[model samples]
Target chain A: MAFRTDHHLTGSVNIVTALPAEARPLVGHFELRSSRTDPFSVYTNGDSSVRLIVSGVGKSAAGRAVKHLAGLFDSTGSNAWLNVGIAGHESLPLGTMVAAHKISDEKTGRSWFPPMVLDFPCETATLLTVEEETDDYPDNALVEMEAVGFYATASDFSTHELIHCLKVVSDNRREKKLDGKSVSELITAQLAAVESVVQSILQLSAELGKRRVVPRQLKDFLEQWKFTVTQSHQLEKLLRRWEVIFPKADPFEAASPESRNGRDVVQLLSRQLAEASVEAEQL
Target chain B: MIEAIYIEEAVRQHRRTAEILTRFPKARLIPCERYGEVFNPRSQDFKIQKRRPALILAEKFDNFVLPTPDGFGIGGTENYYFSHMLNCLYDCRYCFLQGMFRSAHYLLFVNYESFMDAIDSTLDKSTTDKTVTFFSGYDCDSLALETVTGFAEAFLPFFRERPRALHELRTKSVNIQALLKTEPLDNCVTAFSFTPAEISEKVEHGVPPVKRRIEAMKQLAERGWPLGLRLDPLIYHGRFESNYRRLVNDLFAAVPAEAFHSVSLGAMRFPKAMFDPMVKLYPDELLLAGPLHPSNGMVTYRREVEEEMTQFCRSLLGDYLPAEKFFHCAPWS
Candidate 1:
């Protein structure tokens, strides 16, 4: 709810899928426009941060697309990376949606656990990323083609909280098989669930960003003054203390050019804010 | 209801595991080498899996019982507690388990015989003639999963056999059917934890209401079961004094003050390690707010508030019962 109309301007999201059809619905819903074509078919809304990449149909493609997007927006690995696509499960009905609690590589017999910290109302299952489709299913996991590549790569680029995979079942052993068109339909049907998950990531990222960011007023003042890296960090802390002491108000409106240096400016603000806090408390 | 049952390969053929499996045929049975592989993984979110927590059946190895923290037990002697389970059936926001564990899956150690044997061996080292009590619900609510685990049914008889030794089934659960179905044991204490109904109704999600818990205590006390009252982690609001006074009045009105075997008073405190995780798990709750700081690696209410709340409640409790029947849980106390 807080992130509407933010694509291509600010905020961060990188979506990766196995096919263009799988990316089609998301590209439209996020209003993402076409962009760079380095690693794979890439689309964006012109903002450097929000992006989508079609990784073709295998692990390498998924890995390359992630590397490309990570180099673009997630150099700090704090932004969200979401892998949305269709998977096959043996018994789960077609079109059933699930979040991955476990992601395993079928070839290596190695698995990665996905932390399920937030309680969204969705059933969870383990997803096994296989190289090719086979007659026999290995375990009771959603069978997919790119989860391992997506998870292993995306995780290296972001914290586990910001990396997630949502899969909609496209085929089961006992059910009628699905084609490219049906797979697109299955994905389209679950866009609402995907949208909810996106909102959750944005909310979490925003919460984290709030704590990390300095106030715009403080940033402007710092840019004007030639402060060293360490002093900049100190200024950030003082700004936060100022905010906690005097919330919903700015302290820069009273600044005068009497401060001789960057350190003087910081001390002047800190002293004034401290006095203001003591006065407020007494009141 | 559990959506799946993950069984450790070692305990897959255990009779207890087999019996539980029969009851949940609809639930998917998953096999794993160890319960931690399923229960302790970081990816399995406690809040998410809690919506449909899977039951993990595994074998316990070593550390069957551990010493309780100082100022915790009823008597002024050395005390210890053990956990047959890891988490609770209810989702109380103040619960320490939220911070101590990353996953919310219910881990049921199928090897009860091993635990009983360990308890028996522990009591055999009798240093003095005075009775030493062993608490049963530190990491979990002891009787909360009684219907499914039959924990009290198994351990009550074990305690009954050794009358000199004691066991306390500490809980906030009203799942007393197994205990009520049979006779109550003198050596056992059915401890019911409580907070003011107003606070509990807000933060203690999934717990039976305070009225119902008191009703269950009444029935058990009438059957001659030694009852315990746990007012640990006492949450304070604007009207804390009036709210707590009302709770104590309502509690004593139903189950007479004389019926309580002992009452333990604990002010709201958290180990420093647990505070941040609990805060992260539920960031918007007012519970974490205060002009408070950590002291000696523990986070608690302001010193004056803690002392006032504890002293006020202790004085009130003292009016109804003797001094020996209450144990103060705050560090200063």
Candidate 2:
């Protein structure tokens, strides 16, 4: 079954962040895969719901999170995909929110993220997804590790309109300094904002579900639209001959034997044949 | 061809212009400063223009010819093509003239004498060893405007006298009544560009329908005028495979299969810079609907997409024409 047929989501915003101190209250459920591994945390504020699956910190981990979420969507019949995470920025002040219009791999020059559509006051620019850790942000607006891979994999499971990747700036790479406790606290604090964005996305998905339709009739019409000119011309010429031969049965005058009667018989037979052809095609 | 002179006349006395006067009597005869002003015009209605369009005549000056495109040999290493007029009467949405020029006005350079002189000199300089191919339908439909202009009637004998030279009159028009009226030339070819009726009806605006063109082709082929088929800019869309197959089948049914001299196939390719302008003109065209991406310096259907279209059309052509006679003009991978 098409995922869009069963489930739909819509919202104006895809994500919002909460500080780590404010995060514990919003936590819905937790899973322990291993003691050595980071715990997978699920959270919801009753209004909006999400699961933060921690795959440990790396490009592969980010890609793995996307695949896990895709499987969740496939199994559960969910229609929307969103990647919400923290990102490092250059030149911009910390805690400022920006939208990524495009995400490209600096090394390979392949775009992984879809172009962003932002509301007023939210600036849009390039976001670079890198494999290397702690490098200078090269002349771009934002830097992230996971958003690109998440988007590239998630896109296969979702419609272009239904998929979104939102990155909130949490660290300045150039300064190389971050209060780790405070960064976590900031994410927990912004839980309400992130939930509101997902709510909006859910509404948009519902609207798209209404517009999706299979064009079975137009496809059939196109299939039967023949290309032969002789057939088209022959039909046209026969129609013209009937019009000349009949001259539309005059209401005021009586049918004459020599002219009108003979032509009327031929015209009636031609019309019957034309009507039969139409009926046969319809069947 | 008889000697004719070019004059800077304030008024043109041609039959087509007379017909235009009858239609739009109050239409002003605006004088242009240069042939380039009207040829590569800066302003005119492109969409409002109709096929079998009338011309606004002006005198052509000293420079009548220029260098041709690279590797453009028709039958030899020294192939060259030139346009004596600018813009076509037919308004096919896929035509390159819509992307090449800024305006839609028909600029007839009333300087037949100078164009002939340049051709004479070019021929004299080349030693006539290598075949010089002069293409006349690059910018406009060659014989569509021939009834009034009498261009083919004049150019046919010139090529007939020079057996080494070959002229290709490429057109999608059924305006070959003039060409048929005159004696058929041995070295001259009347090349026809055709598409399936379904595609032609949807995109080939303001031109004669495909049925009329097929009838004209059959007449020309029957009269023994060497014909060439151009399946260039092969537009691929839904049902393209079946539609093109039907088109080839219909054409072969209408005319003799062995009557064709050559067949050329080219997938659509356009310069990168032409993308914005062409898209602006035809925003909703389906020709731009394929898997298009920028390659090298041009925006074209991706290499795989181009190959699929070319291979499909080439195979369809092979059913009727010999594989040896079928030549692909698409750039090699």
Candidate 3:
């Protein structure tokens, strides 16, 4: 699928929640509009940079929702994925916001540790995704469902650094269950923390987009000559070299009317750049 | 400062781990079964993680001290290298660590005693007449994290007792307070690596400036510590001759040539496996884009360019130091 030109999809954020109550705070804050409700409830902002999907309440449902959301957009690894929902801990108080440093699947015995490269403004805890709900909680960990599925599926599309899970403590030993209104209120109270984490991820994603940008002249070169897949790759590298070695000079000045195809252009550029005297930029 | 620290389950209660944890009280502590579980996974972006890398404390099981490549030494018949850490704190665009490791987190083996024991066994097996040199800072900077690791404070005294064994602490960091406080040992050489000031400022991120490093070296020389100069990986540029000449003059002017234990020169080269990833990490880096070609499974400057750059620097260095003090490192095989 191709991204809509009207939307800025690069450096975007895709949020997945297991319940509408869990996703309502984010959807309201980001000013998202309900785009569809067929397979799953989906909402998106006007620019489509911020998207949310509410999967109904199981691990398999969360996994399918993540896959469905990813299939709708052309995410270029620069977009961030966040799985935000409520979890249960043994002794922690309600409304305590915690980010997951480690995620484990109780049934599959699979685990993933998200690299904490950002200085998040929340406590960190281990998250255990169980197959069935239970009152028993692991020591020094938060218990929940859908995190394993959300994390495992999202990782196939993005790097581990850009994928994260944030959980708000809704139920504990003191409080076994919370009503839908209570769940929505708990998430609403910690909206600032959610915003902070999403902003940091967006900053990182934007920085990555800058690094992956191709030279502007590459498009013109492709239009001027016929290049096979292999030759196109070579042409891009050569153009980047030219841009670095001679920032102010035009690269086409080195090409001749005799050049008929991308192969000839690649060879000519390579030969010219090879003989050029390069200088390291002074600080 | 470290923001998070990943501790291996094996070393969670170790004395060194506890001490390191106390230094960073605010850091988030994450526990794992093995350092490899957090450090060796695929799909971890080196550049992104490098912005704020965590520290992984683990216990290394074996192979603490191993033989250096055939020509990677300075005047020692038997040369071996050991690393207490796996990655450097600085982010030089040309560093091979970015390509060699999947993750950018600093993996420091907390078991220093095990490394010392391995070195001692290697020394005992060596012939008494020949010097057994132990090279540090191959995989990471020896002194960059000295304040946190206490690596120099713990290992200096051990090397002081062995007169037949030599230790080379190679680094580009000016974190030499640990060395300054202790009495200078004759068997230990604190070597400093450098490129020209212009090239260093552009590529070597977070490294101390050239002037500050020279001042630190002068202080070490005054304290009677044997010093070494590493002009290795000579970056090729249009002003190579003038830049290198000025750098050599600045060093000799600050510290006397007699204080230098050795001087070495090597051309910039990387294995194809490493070069490809580094380019992918920093596509706009000028150093990687300049006049480099693949030959014999390694990426390096043309033979003539490498020889000319090395020969010019060697000739300039000869004016200040004798030929016996010079060592030229060949490209890695």
Candidate 4:
């Protein structure tokens, strides 16, 4: 059900999985509706937020799926990418949900440490993404099929904080076999843990969203002053700083120095900004 | 409070590393060949990672002891600085560490003995008459993480033996329980950094309040620990003179001025290289708005404002302590 021209895909959350069964419980629980106009099965909320994509198994598939979904649904780069699936841990009990502290691609032997800032009560473990499930859990990590691909691709789309993989332990060495129904049930059982992670990620997403958004006054100033490509970037960065330091003060309401070029305006703002900054720190 | 600790594979078997691992039994220990493999990546965002910084137990190779910048010392013959840690526990907005390193994670070089050996050799070569002052909190808070690293406990004895080489543990931390238990030595100076309570509440993230820091200094002074005051990077906040005056008047009253070993003062400044990046890192901070001008090569307060501030403080501080005890650090010193 995934489609092109996601102009209506103005969502803040993207949930991707390697299989349809793994994505089913989340889509159903969150009331995600599938569309008939897309090539892949994509479930979207009625509010046009929270897209669930069921990419086929393997690293390439997961990477391709993220690229496709991100291109269509995440124009803002603000969406949190959640790659959910079943993984095999050497010792963790079946159905145990552990958020990844470190994710390493088995074939490449490369690793990425996701800074676990949120203090969740659930157990934490390293994840090794392999091409296929293995009984020989080589290292002390949760073995999965889609993490590296998801992380490698999703991180390119959004911040690493916004891109994370939450896996449910479905197999270890002894319990290697699992049917589709069993996988679905295992994924469904860890929904609560998944929700907790989602909430934390969303909170981080929201905080970053505020910091990046340009205020209306800066936009108006940009329209009035002819800032060059370089100055515009500086202005944007400065305005974000302004919002942080002088949260209550209004940039537009401040006394305007009339008839100045972009350079002059920048200089004026810089002077006022510096004074305000120093003053703010003063007792 | 640490959720994850990235341990360098080389130090996995080190006794100190093992002992630290035992303390944080809950943190997931990620193994790597070198700390740089985990710490030197450009992909890591200092902002996002700052929300929850990991503890990297690493092994520092060279440059264990370096000379302090020309004006960084509080008066001495030969001043040298060393960092057993790469980063700090508290996040001060004005700190140069933010721009100096790409990662916000704290990297503790577990090989403290190597550093002491380096210090020992360096000090052994110097003449005993020339008082060599070694600064400890150059790259990180020397005492803020005392309990976690047992840094002060380990080094106090090292300095006690090397009486000719004085040690200054500059920190904003109040964790002096370790020092309280040991015999306070004159060769060691426990320097406490302070800012206006009003400014501290805003920019010095994760640091104890001004009152708490002052209390810690008083406790240390009472216990015979030679106390030094570092009013460095004095933020030029509004009505700074009154704030500073009240602060000094209040402080000198509690911890007798006679007990003070030294007091160093400096204005807030950043290298142009560090300033630009800091602007990007803390766009919302008023501190960077400084209409800061580049003098020579560093970005700092205007010459006039800097003079006024330093002169005012120098005059005010002269009222509390002996004129010889006050030291002025030039901007970016």
Best by TM-score: 3
Q: Model 2 fnat?
A: 0.00
Better of 1 and 4 by lDDT: 4
lDDT tens per residue, model 4, A1-283 = 3233332223267788888779888988778888532555778877656678888888888888888887766355567788899888787789888888778888998887666777664777888888875687755788888889888888777767677788888888668536788888998888888777777777766665554556557778787778898887767665665665667776655525453766766766666666653565331
Q: On a 0 to 100 scale, what is the lDDT of residue A29 in model 1?
A: 81
Comparing candidate 2 with candidate 4, which one achieves the higher lDDT? Answer: 4
Ranking by DockQ: 3, 4, 1, 2
Candidate 2 per-residue lDDT, tens place, B1-333, comes to: 101111124336645335434544433233333444333423222432322233556666666765456654345555556677777766777676776765555666655667778887878888648777777888788987675466787788777888777788988889898778877776787888877778778777767887898899999988888888888767656576787788888888998987787788877677756664565444334454223445687866656667887888888888888876765333222
Predicted structure 4: lDDT: 0.78
Q: Which 10-residue window of candidate 3 chain A scores lowest in summed lDDT? A: A1-10
Better structure of 1 and 2 per lDDT: 1
- List model 4 lDDT by residue over B1-333, tens digit each: 776889888899999998888888977777876787667765455777787888999998898899877776667778898999978889888888888887888999999999999899888888757778888988899998887798999999899998888899989999998899999998999888888887888888899988888888889889889989888877776678898898888788889887789988888888888887676666566676654666777888887777788888888888887888886433366
Residue-wise lDDT of candidate 3 within A173-246, one digit each (tens)? 87854688999999999999999999988887766666667877988888888899998998888888788777
Clashing pairs in 3: none
Per-candidate TM-score, chain A: 0.79, 0.56, 0.93, 0.84
Model 2, A52-101: lDDT tens digits are 44444445566665565444333222345555556677777665655554
Expressed as tens digits, the lDDT of each residue in A1-283 for candidate 1 is 1123332223477889998778888888888887766557778765545678899887777988898777655354356778999888888898899988778888987776555544455788888888986656556788888988998888776656667899888778887445777778888888888888887776655554443454557767776676777777656655655555556666565444566667876777655543341211111
| Residues B1-333, model 1: lDDT tens digits | 876787788998899998888888777566667777666645333554566677889999989977776776776375777888999899988888888887788899989998888877777876776676788888889988887888988888888898867788888999998788878787788888888888888778999999999999999888878899888876656677887888888888888777788988777788879876675555444555332345688876667767788888888788888998887433233
Q: Which ten residues in a row are the worst by lDDT in model 4 chain A?
A: A2-11
Please rank every candidate by TM-score, starting with the best.
3, 4, 1, 2
Instruction: State the DockQ, from 0 to 1, for candidate 1.
Output: 0.13
